[model samples]
Target: MVIETLPARLDPEEAKRVRQERLERIGSWLLPLLIMLFAIWLWDRICVWNEIPRYILPRPHVVAQTLYTDAALLFGSLLVTLKITFLSLLLAVIGGVGLAVLFTQSKWVEMSFFPFAIVLQVTPIVAIFPLINIYVDNQTAKLLLCSWIVAFFPILSNTTLGLNSVDRNLRDLFRLNGATRWQKLRHLRLPAAMPYFLGGLKIAGGLSLIGAVVAEFVAGSSGQSSGLASRIIEAGYRLNAPRLFAALILISLTGILIFLVLSLVSHLLLRRWHESALKQER
Candidate 1:
């Protein structure tokens, strides 16, 4: 006897879900863009109607003009700020992960120094910057230290949590297999802690930028090599509203870029195995 087979088809619900996802993604981008344009339009209309002075409330166009006119100078300052932010972030990762590993290795050491980490986290960078500036003669080093202070605690705490949260079963399996301490750590704990580390990294990136700005403001060092923060301060002192707004826009955009880049790195690293990076499926 001959057997007959028919073609398989996509379930109706699956098709509906696919279309819905596409539309949602499109709306997510389009709606925010539309709202931003509308707000800008309203701002321009209000400024025009109220006859506000440019020095007090410059129109969006005026800010755009300022951004373009000063792009070269502003971007150069932005590079300086970025250097401090990224250098801080890099150092925080190295120190945080190294300390976290040490803590995982020895409970006595963790108990001893964990309080100091908290103290650093809780003390406002502004309050600390004054003392740091007193001792740290190199201006760049001062900014780096302040930014690192702001970024360090998150990575250390999150990584510690992740290291301790590994599957008990897998740990037992490692023990049963007679795995050495280094082997178990390399094969099990570090992998489990990756997601937490990335999450902390995202938070650290933004905080580092904020710390860099705060340190710059505190330093108030003026010259050809001043960072964006210095430009903001200079604009404020000169009552240059347009320039101030432009500088703020650059900082905000930089923070956004840093966040997106870190998020992409996390997704790329975790997408194959981690549930946090996986999309839920019906």
Candidate 2:
């Protein structure tokens, strides 16, 4: 028998869908880049047209040049901030997840303590920093505590929600099969909670960075080991607009990088089995 040949041309709808997917894939990144460049060009033109002094609004190129020239100082500060951020995130994860597990095991414990978590979350970090600053003598400890407070609640709440959200049918089935609490937790709840934990991780990552910077601003610490926030303050004091812009750019970039890294981690962890990470036919 002769082998059947596949069609050379795709159906019209299939061809249209393929083209759309290609366009979307390209446009997702390209459009944002184009818009960002346009915004920068507009900013430069506005500064030039208004005859603004460098002390007021430095041109993008000047800010870029400042980034290059001040790389040593800025990068060092970045390291300090990053250290606080990462340490805080690590602590938050440990505390949050541990607490969530306890809450899942005991409703009494959850009711007794969850309100305190809510209080911490609702209260602004600025309001809480003074207490942290007063109680914590070491500069790094102060920063770490502040960041941890900011990052902790999301993980606790999200993971708790996920753990509690197991299907009733599944629960009954496990019970019928004589599964113990530990078995259900390990085989069912934790796996189901993975997506929620990952989502919270992404949020906590950015919040940890923000908390570190904000804590720096509030503490107003100054020295060789101070963070980008201190550099921003110093730049403002000296009317170093270019340097201030550069510092701001670094903070923005750091937040973006944290989010991207967390998102990648989430995707990698969930891609094989989680519905959210699975590729959709559509």
Candidate 3:
């Protein structure tokens, strides 16, 4: 006699695992949010209990109010800062990938120019901004150049490493198949290099924002054309701590948004095929 198989239903172990993973993900976000709320409560309590002046350490509400009251000014400044950040990131991607391609084609080119890239990266933007300010007549150009300098090297290095990281066996197979150099690059090398390029892009995004802010700080460009860094400096001079905190919050949020967007991009592109995006269950 043969036994009949049971009807399909949820596996107890699999369901338990899924629920545990969901809780962990939710807790990951919730825990930090709860901590932040507690910190804010602590800050508000300290200010109220000690009668701390608004100029010294305004309550959280004051910072929120400042953000709302100066929304036009702060947002406008943020737009300028964002403009610089995005443009620099774009230029870095172009220049970095272009040079990395050249490097892949010729070892001599990599050896010749890679050191210069490293120099630009290692030299603090604060130091370079003075020279850039003097040499670059256009203020916007100076800011863009300063930002691009910091963002450039990561993309260049990562892409170069990716391009060269192709498996030897894959290259040999392509060669055996009579694949041309361009074909090998398009079909074999580029895909292998994508994760590295995306990784570089994510790093470059944050660096570009930092470079823009640092350049603005050093340049001390103010008035209508000023970026968030200028607002921060102006707030410091006026002893407007709430406004300073608000500006800082904007900058931090901008950075976090950039990173999240880049991370989403990486996940979307890689989820179908890459090991980095794959979910491994124990």
Candidate 4:
């Protein structure tokens, strides 16, 4: 017998839901770009209307031009800043995750050490930079230490919270199953802490950049190896607003890119099962 099968139809609600999701996805990218263009246009118009000199506030196009013209110098400084930011973030992740794991293992250790971490976090880098400079003579090491101090606390605190936030029932179940500490950590706590760790990492990424820039500002060390902050300072001294704006743009773009990359990592890692990254059927 030959049978003809008709094509299945999607549910009306599901079709509407899919369309909404698509629109939302498109809007997410489109809206920010539109707003940015509008802002740039307004800025250019304001500069033209007021006859403002480029020395004070260069038009966006002028800044763009400067970026193109000074790409080599700007990018070199960017590379230096990026190196410190990334290195600090890496160290923060290692130290924070390791310490958090240790905290989970023992309350006494956490009580003894967590306060020092808190002190480091709460104390302004500027306040401690003098001491750092006095003791650590290397410019690069100072930048790394300052950035690491700024980035370290978020990861440590967030990961600690996540590790301790495990569901009692689930933990009891694991215990009932005769799971070892390592097994429980590997299978349960780590997975549970993933979201928190990612959240902290996103914050730390921006903080690392800020710390690197601030450290550079404090160091005030001139030369080719200096970061974007040095360029900003030099531009200020020379009254070269365009170059300063260009440097600022690079820093802003760098921060945005770091955030986007970390967010993508978080979404990719969590989307499979975690609620925060999962798409809701609203």
For this target, which candidate reaches the highest TM-score against the unseen true structure? 2
Tens-digit per-residue lDDT, 87-198, candidate 3: 9999999999999989998889889989998988898888877788778888789899999999989999999999999999999999999998789889998899999999
For model 1, which pairs clash?
none
At residue 110, what lDDT does model 2 achieve? 96
**Candidate 3 accuracy as lDDT:** 0.92
Runs with alpha carbons beyond 4 Å of true place in candidate 3 = 1-18, 221-224
Which scores greater on TM-score, model 2 or model 4? 2
**lDDT by residue for model 4 (1-282), tens:** 223663377688877876998999999999999998999999999999999999999999999999999999999999999999999999999999999999999999999999999998999999999899889877899899999999989999999999999999999999999999999999999999999999999999999999999999988753544799999999999999999999999999999999999999999999888888876553
Residue 53, candidate 4: C-alpha displacement in angstroms: 1.2
Q: What TM-score does prediction 4 earn?
A: 0.91
Question: Per-prediction TM-score, please?
Answer: 0.93, 0.94, 0.93, 0.91
The local lDDT score (0 to 100) that residue 50 gets in candidate 2 is 99
Worst 10 residues of 3 by lDDT: 1-10
Q: What's the CA error at residue 265 for candidate 2, in Å?
A: 0.8
The segments of candidate 2 whose C-alpha lies over 4 angstroms from its true place after superposition are: 1-7, 221-225
Model 2 Cα shift for residue 3 (angstroms): 21
lDDT of 1 by residue, 70-162 (tens): 999899999999999999999999999989989898889999999999998999999988899789888899999999999988999999888
- lDDT string for model 2 (1-282, tens) is 233774789899988987999999999999999999999999999999999999999999999999999999999999999999999999999999999999999999999999999998999999988888778888898888889999999999999999999999999999999999999999989988899999999999999999999999999853543899999999999999999999999999999999999999999999888888887754
